[model samples]
Target: MRKTATTLADGRELIYFDDTEPYTSGAATRELRDRRDLDPVAATSTMRYDVLTGEWVTLASHRNSRTFLPAVAECPLCPTRADRPATEIPAEDYDVVVFENRFPSLARGAEPPATDHVDGDDLWPQRPASGRCEVVCFTSDHDLGFAELPLPRVRTVLAALVDRTRALSALPGIAQVYCFENRGEEIGVTLGHPHGQIYAYPALPPRTEALLRQSRAHHARTGRVLLRDVLDAERRSGRRIVATTEHWTAYVPAAARWPVEVHVAPNRDVADLTELRDPELEDLAALYLDVLGRLDRFFDGVGKLPYIAGWHQAPVEEGRELGRLYLQVFSLMRAPHRMKFLAGSESGMGAWISDTTPEAIAARFRAIAPGPVPS
Candidate 1:
């Protein structure tokens, strides 16, 4: 693989990862400069600590002003043209590109103004939103979905993520690195391009904290890895298992809260994406493609599904022993024409109630053969 990093017009970092031999072998000539004259935007975000919930809430009001879904010609993720205004990517074409988010929820090394609220007070203390948020464009095409990419392309995407994970973890204050994709409008995707995001947080998020607590307690109690045990239990039951290969297993979690949820875990206990072997990555690409193909046709009338796919890896500074690498892919679509809303029980009370059972969902996923959706 070939990797090149450059600074965008606004002083943010943009990188390109090429998988072709010509690029990797340094036999292809390329334009490595960004050709736009843009002024830097003064943006900083603050984080308030929720004393009641023990969580951090980022206040990035500027996100409301970011671009929404635009026409294909005005898509910000597409390559730039000489006759058109320069988009986020300055290059005319790219295989996979990653850059810092223009409207970021968290800014690296940014210092927000201090507040007069008492630090000892229950719910008044605040801090700077010091971290990073990066956007990873999976393909240059405006209409391509991740599942439609070829395996070699998928492998390259994985490689890009792996490199970012390692690089982001080494950043001075980053605590956790989250790589995820929000696809389709139902998933609250403002852009229609095939892309995912990476969030490098200064503090461990609540979800990862809870996971570490569980993992540590489980290890202390059973002396076995938590994720490995879960995988074994699923394999033994065979009720929620969707698909399994020599290196990985994809299954609907036994206590799934979403209408459609699948967890694809490696057969061996791996700390993060950077630890996966070459054979493991290849097998992962194949299995992930299969699972996504089934998801595209889950509903009878919906040709493509709206979903969120995220990787839960070990935190950068802590929980290295108990942290495990895995992916959780779930959709919000409840039926052919219905949607799953986080109503009172879910959003207001923090309790989730799914309409479909895990076994049934697993069976549905298994029954659907991998194929293209009807045009």
Candidate 2:
């Protein structure tokens, strides 16, 4: 792959990952100059400490005015063409591209707040939300979804993500790096373009904290990796197993809370995507596409199933040894026409209630599995 990095008109970073002939061979160059007149980025987001839950909540009020469901002609994610207005990507076409978010919840180079307390209360401390948020455009074809991508294109996307993860993890004060995609309108995806997001957080998220606690405790008692053990147990039980490959396994968690949930783990223990070998990455691309195809077929008449898929990686500076990398995919679609809303028990409290059992979900997934894809 050929990687070319350039700056946007607004001073944000944009990168292109080219896998095709001329670009990869250095016979041609990507359009690096962003000529459109644009204003400089203004970052004013802040993080307030929630005393009750011991979590940091980012307040990016400016995001309220962000672009929402614009027409296809105005989609900023599309490639820049002469007939159309210049978009976020300066190139006329691209295999894969990633750029800083125009309206980010977190931003780079933010100055520290003058006072740490909120309303003179010692419990409510606040600070600048100094972090990085990026958007990964999977394809220039605005109509194509990720699952419909060719295998080579999928591989390029994975490579770009691994490259970003390594680069983001090396950045100062970045606690964790997360790569995720929210698909479909029901999943609250504002953009119809095929894309995902990368977040470099200044602080560890609550979910990572909870996972670390469990892993640490499990290691202390048994001296074995928690997730590795879970994978082994799941393989032995074979009850929630959805799909398995030479390097990966897809299964439903025994206590799944989503209407449809599947966790994909490496057969070998790895802390993050950066640790995955070439063979493993290739296997992942194939398995991911296959699983996603099955998900679309899971609910008849539902068309494309709206789901959230995220990579759970180890923190940059903490719990690396105890961490096991995995991809968690879940959808809010409880039925063909019904949606699962996080009610009082789930949203108000940290408790989850499931409408279907994990075994049933897994069985359905197994039944609908598309077998394999051509290389």
Candidate 3:
């Protein structure tokens, strides 16, 4: 793959990842320049450390004014078209594109400066939410989604993700780099576009923090990688396995909290997406695409199932050794016509209530799997 990096009108960076041969030969037809005159990028988001939960909360008031569910003709993620106004992507067509988010919750060099004179206030500790947020466009078309893309195109998307993961991890003050996709309207996806988000967080997120703690404890006790052990247990049990390849495994976790949840982990102990070898990448794409296809087929009457797919990676600064790369895909849809909403037990207490068992979900996934597994 060839990378062509350029700057958007708003001074944000945009990169185009193109495949060799036919795509690169016809690259001249693609838009290489931004036609729109936009203002400079600015971010004032601040993070306040919560001593109670031991997590940072970002206050990005500007995000309230962002575009929400725009019409297809006005979707900012779509490629710039002659029939409509210029969108966020200035390209006429692109196999895959990633650009700095305009309404970002975190940004580079946007950190609040340090104060030397103030007394150490433990109760009101705040810092600049200085980190980068990039939007990964899976394709030029506005109607298609990641799960609907061809395998080759899916590989192209993974290439872009690997590129961004490596690049974002190198940025200063970046602690954790998370790549995630929010699909369907029920998932609170503001934009109905075929795109995912890369958030370079200023600090370790709550979920990653929990994983690091558990993994470190497990490693200290058993002298083995926790995720690898879990994968082994799943394979041995042969009950929750969703799909498997030589280099990857997809399973509905035994303690799955969501109605539909599956975790896809690389067989190797890769710290991040960048460490995935070529063969692993190839098979990862195929197996992930298969898992996604099964997800869409899991429900009958529901159109496109609303789901959140998140990549859990190790922090950039610390505990990377304990970090195991995995993708957690889950949905709140409890049934074909019913949606599970987080109420008092989940929202107020943080305790998840699952309407279905993990084994049942795994059985549904197994039934929809494209091919039968080996004995």
Candidate 4:
């Protein structure tokens, strides 16, 4: 599966890649293909990369128009429909359910083009597009967000994440697992359900790839994990520490790119939370909940605040201990009621101009005493 150009209805080019098709039998692909339980389902999502912007897009074929604004009475992700057919799941019985996204950004089981590369000055090799996109529903409740769920329930969600990570990482072509949640309509969510998507890619993303290069360089010289040392320094400095436990710490990064960006990283050099022992899993979950609770209290429970949360870890090819696993949450609010906008520098030049300093964001988060568990 390699990327080839396809034209969208709007006449823009959409680069398509189908992972199920053979591309290169590299080490990464071999590992990914072996994970049968989690590989791309028979009817998987379609993926295309944008040639100009270098952004990957997923288009899932299983999703129909009706799946977008489903009524509460017809919510299929709810627990009551565990045994229901694929098309008629009832809503309301599940604690956590992992399913194929109804309207996936990536369509499954697509066929890669026989030849995607063309002789042109602007052309680069299109990487094979193979991977799985899954939505993990956190709860069966129609209106409950992660912050509104009980502590134990939230723990279940985290555990599911770890499980899915492990399952997907074992597949043949997957090079990385990207997990994230986009909350609120401000982030352009088409559904009101409390769920997040997991993407198992055949190669590392550009940002992750860059981080890997930096870490490899650092390790070649210092024989230490860059993130591990950074976590230690941040703990000793204490300027940005939000909360710390035996296994995890939440703090604001000194080089934060957003106004209210909070990160929870493992004190040890664990690539992803999936590698944590059972006991450590609970600690990671506890720390995650602690930070989220703080965020909820900061916003006064309106739940209208928009935010994005994503996990950053070393690529699967880098081994499980190459980098410390961390979660970053960035709030869209830059001022009391105003949202931050990405103008010329950010949108056009790929440069970020932050309005708030990391130190100030850290101080503000520190001032808010950790409130009761969010639920």
Question: Which candidate number has the best TM-score?
Answer: 2
Q: For every model shown, what is its TM-score relative to the native structure?
A: 0.95, 0.96, 0.94, 0.78
Across 1-375, the per-residue lDDT of candidate 4 in tens digits comes to: 232232222222222222222432121222222111222333444445557767654445555543555666555554333343322122223356565553444423445634444332234334335666777777656687776677666666777777778877887777788888888776666667787778777656778766777887889999988788788889999998888888788889989988779988877667786777866777876677667767765644444457788998667875445666889998877765567888899989989999878888888787777656444
> In terms of TM-score, which candidate is stronger, 1 or 2?
2
Q: What RMSD does model 1 have?
A: 2.1
Q: Which stretches of candidate 2 lie over 4 Å from their true place?
A: 24-32, 371-375
Residue-level lDDT of model 2, residues 1-375, one tens digit each, is 889888888899888899986663122233347888887776888899999999999998989989898899999999877898888988778889999999998999866777888886899999999999999999999998888899999999999999999999999999999999999988778889999999999999999999899999999999998899999999999999999999999999998999999999999889999999999999999999999988888887876889999999989998888888999999999999799999899999979989999999999999994833222
Whole-model lDDT per candidate: 0.87, 0.90, 0.85, 0.65
Per-candidate Cα RMSD to the true structure, in Å, reads: 2.1, 2.3, 3.4, 10.6
The lDDT, on a scale of 0 to 1, for candidate 1 is 0.87
Which candidate achieves the best lDDT against the true structure?
2
Model 3: residues with Cα > 4 Å off, grouped in runs? 20-32, 113-121, 371-375
* Per-residue lDDT of model 1, residues 23-102, tens digit only: 53122214535566776744578888877788888888878888898878888898777777778887777788899998
State the lDDT at 187 in candidate 3. 74
lDDT of 2: 0.90
Q: What is the full ranking by lDDT, best candidate first?
A: 2, 1, 3, 4
Pitting candidate 2 against candidate 4, the one with the higher TM-score is 2
Q: What is the lDDT, from 0 to 100, of the residue 332 in candidate 3?
A: 87
Q: Which structure is stronger by TM-score: 1 or 4?
A: 1
Better of 1 and 2 by lDDT: 2
